[model samples]
Target: MSGETPLPATDPRSSPTRRISIVHVRSGVHILPREMLGTSTFGVAMKLLKWLPTQVVDRFLLIMAKMMIGDTEKYGLKRPKVGPLELKNTTGKTPVLDVGALSLIRDERIKIVSEVESLTSDGARFVDGGEMAFHAVVFATGYKSNVPLWLKDAGGVLTAEGKPEEHPFPNGEKGIYFVGFSGKGLLGASVDAIKTALDVSARWTRLSETKDVVGL
Candidate 1:
């Protein structure tokens, strides 16, 4: 938690009333509840992306992004050069919830920059040929699955990148079940957990019967 800044009382994330209103509820038509995105309905929609035309999906996402932001010029920002898909593919598919992030950027309370090129004594050089002094540098590198690192026998279960070799949810290989690789986030993970539990239960019951038969 180094270099953590104090949240202002005005920030929505810090406000008790705002927090209560937003939590577990859809605040408006424009804003869908975060929980709904993890539901089965949303999972089906995401799955449909595999079959939908890339151009159509990209256009839809771009329109949605524009609708969410409305006018970028009002916030002292220019339109983004890249579409949502490119950003998602490059940075991964996690949606950033803006509690006070937009306000911070608009007020210049924090700085967003390009990829770092190298580290210097004072600060860091960026890919965009910019450098600035900093009190601290925190790496916001994306998450990586650690399954491949620790799991000894990951032959059929996981790939080199630690992703499930099998497509979609319920990915398993040789009795080894994987959760959270479906890319549907929490809902997919929950589904995997249930499936794994049922499978394991059945196997355990059969094993118990075999032991009883052998009188062991």
Candidate 2:
């Protein structure tokens, strides 16, 4: 946000026709269009990546990012520093692409603030001792799992942060099982649900047979 990129003032992309300004505050992020992810080419690349070495796959993603997002440096922004896979590994979720986000960001009507010192009813104060007044502020920061707060005991299978510790998808402990903990999204959740239902049904049938044999 602090760096200067010599863009022509006449550039229509950054036109200052509107008085409303949007301030984007964040650490570095990785951005890719949702449509790109759905492409057949991308899907094929993913399948091929599984057979390649990690180093090669990472370099391949780096090249793919440049091809998709263009040269971020040319805009005087150093964001999208982490690739998609790296971001997913660190955060446990993939980035959601907002349509036209890139264009909105590069507009002259928008400002980027990387650090904030404080916030008040009036506006936000930056770490650099600068302040700006705003009519409203919206926080788009993601959510955290609240499982730790309500789950009584997890038998060392879950972390204090409400995430599974034993495996990416938690192994069933006692009678408790977890679904949608794999960070693979809804499709992963659906698969987990089906597996859980089948396992529970099998256990129930065995219990019923045991009770019948005992005449209870």
lDDT scores in order: 0.49, 0.58
Q: Which prediction has the highest TM-score against the true structure?
A: 2
Score residue 61 of candidate 1 by CA lDDT: 52
Which consecutive 10 residues in model 1 have the weakest lDDT in total? 20-29
Model 1, 115-181: lDDT tens per residue? 4567678666666797655545455334678878888875766788988785544434576777767
Encode model 2's per-residue lDDT on 1-216: one tens digit a residue. Answer: 211221111222333665544444355544444444557433644675679754466566556666876755444345555655555545554544536646656764445553666775666677778766665555655678998888776668678778777653334567778888777566467778987888788888999999999996
Which residue pairs of candidate 1 clash?
none
Clashes of 1: 0
| TM-score versus the correct structure, for each prediction | 0.53, 0.66
Global local distance difference test of model 1: 0.49
